[model samples]
Target: MPVSGTTKNTAYTIVASSLLAVCLAYIGWTWLMSSGNPVLTDVVLKLPLGENGFIYGVKDDRGGATVPFSYRYYVYRELTSNEQIASELKTAGPFLVTRDPAIKVDIQGSTINVSTNQEVYEYHSSTLFRHTNSNHYTPVTINLCKHSSDQPTK
Candidate 1:
C-alpha cells in the first residue's frame, strides 16, 4: 500500500509544530532565569580620606540614588617579618545600625565615594584613627538597593 499525500502533509505539520513549541519553551525559560535577579552592573565607590575619616558613598550607574546597605569595621595590628607579614586585629560589628541614614556609599574599584548632595558624613570607627598602615585597612561591601520610585528621570 502507498501512503496518501494528505498523510505525509499531516506528519510534516506535526513535526514542525513540535519543534516550534520546544523553541518557544526554551526562550521562555531563559528569560525567567535572567529576570529573577536585579544586578548592579556598573558601580563606583569613592572614599575620600577627610579630616574626620573616610567619606563613603556610591554613584548609581542606573541613574538612581544609592542607600547605605551594610558595612563592617575592624581594627588590626601589623605582624611582619623579613619575608611575610600578617595582622592580629579585633573584628567589630557588621553593624546593622545605619551610621548615616541620609548618606549612601558604593564600591567602585578600590575607593568608596560619598554623595555630594549632602555634607560629608564621617564613618566612625574607633580604629579608623589608630594607624595609617597598609595592613591596617577597612573592608566595606555594599549592595545597591532599588526603590519603588527609582525610575529614570529622563
Candidate 2:
C-alpha cells in the first residue's frame, strides 16, 4: 500500500497561523505605542523653558539653581564717565550682565552700538551698561526697576 502527503488538519493549521499573525501585529503595535514618551531632560533640551518653568539650568556647569525674579532683574543707564561704569562692575557681577549682557550682538566695536531692543524702563537702584570704546555720553547705570510703571487704574 502507498501513502498520500496531504495534511488532514490543514484548517487547524490555517487558524493557528492566523492567530499567530494577529498576536505578532498586536505586539508590534504595542511596541510602537510604548516607545513615545521620554525623560524630563529630553523635554528640557528640545524646548525652550523659561527661567521659572525650569528648576535648574543644564547649560551652566554647576547645575545652576533658579534665582528669584529679583536677582534676575536688572536696570541699565549710560553716562559720559567710564569710571562710573567700572565702579558698578566692581560691585555687581550679575547685575552688570543682566542690564545689558553685551553689545548689540552685531555692533561690537562700532560707533552705532546701542542696546537694540529698547523696552521702556522706570529705573531702579541696579543697572547694567557697556562702553562705546569711543563715546563718553554712553549709559552708565540704568536702574532695572527704572521702567517700573504703576498698574493701569480702572
Candidate 3:
C-alpha cells in the first residue's frame, strides 16, 4: 500500500525536528566548552629565541574586561624544527600569562628573560572551571639549557 500525504508529512517533520535538535545541541556544546578559555585575537610582539625558536607576545581576550574574563599578555615559544613547514609555526609552550598588557621578552645567551609590570599568573584547569594564581616574580628568567619540558616555566 502507498503512504498517505499526511503520513509522509509527519515523517518529514520528525526527521527535521531531530536534525534541528542535534544542531542546536552541537552549537551549545561548542560554545560552552570554549567560553572560559581566552582566544588569541592578536599578536603584540615576536622576538627571536636562539636560532631556530621564536618568542611570541600575544593578547588573549575572552571578550570581557575583568579578571578571569579579561584580555591578558601571554607568551609562547615556537620552534621551527618541530614542524614540517618552515613558515607555519606552532606554539609549543604557553610560557607565561599576566595582567600587564605590556610585556618584554629577551634572549640573552642561553637565558630567556621575561619582564612585566604585574605579577605572573599560572592557570590550573579543573574539570569544570579554570583557576589562576599569581606565583611568579617579575622579570622572570629561565635558562634554556636547563629547560627541556614543554610545561610552563617560571
Worst 10 residues of 2 by lDDT: 51-60
Q: lDDT, candidate 1, residue 48?
A: 41
lDDT per residue (tens digit) for residues 41-126 in model 2: 21111111121111111111112355311112222233223344333323333321222212232112211112323242222333
Task: List ranges where model 2 is wrong by over 4 Å.
Answer: 1-7, 41-154
lDDT string, candidate 3, 1-154, tens digits:
9989999999999999999999999999999887554466556556654443455555665656654422243233342332221223223235556655556555675356555555566421111111123333233235222122355878
Q: Which candidate, 1 or 3, would have the higher lDDT against the true structure?
A: 3
Count of clashing pairs, candidate 2:
27
Clashes of each: 13, 27, 0
Most lDDT-accurate candidate:
3
Superposing all C-alpha atoms, what RMSD in Å does each candidate have to the true structure?
A: 14.3, 20.4, 13.9
Candidate 3 regions exceeding 4 Å error are: 1-37, 68-92, 123-154
Task: Give me the runs in candidate 1 sitting further than 4 Å from their true place.
Answer: 41-43, 46-154
lDDT agreement of model 3 with the native:
0.49
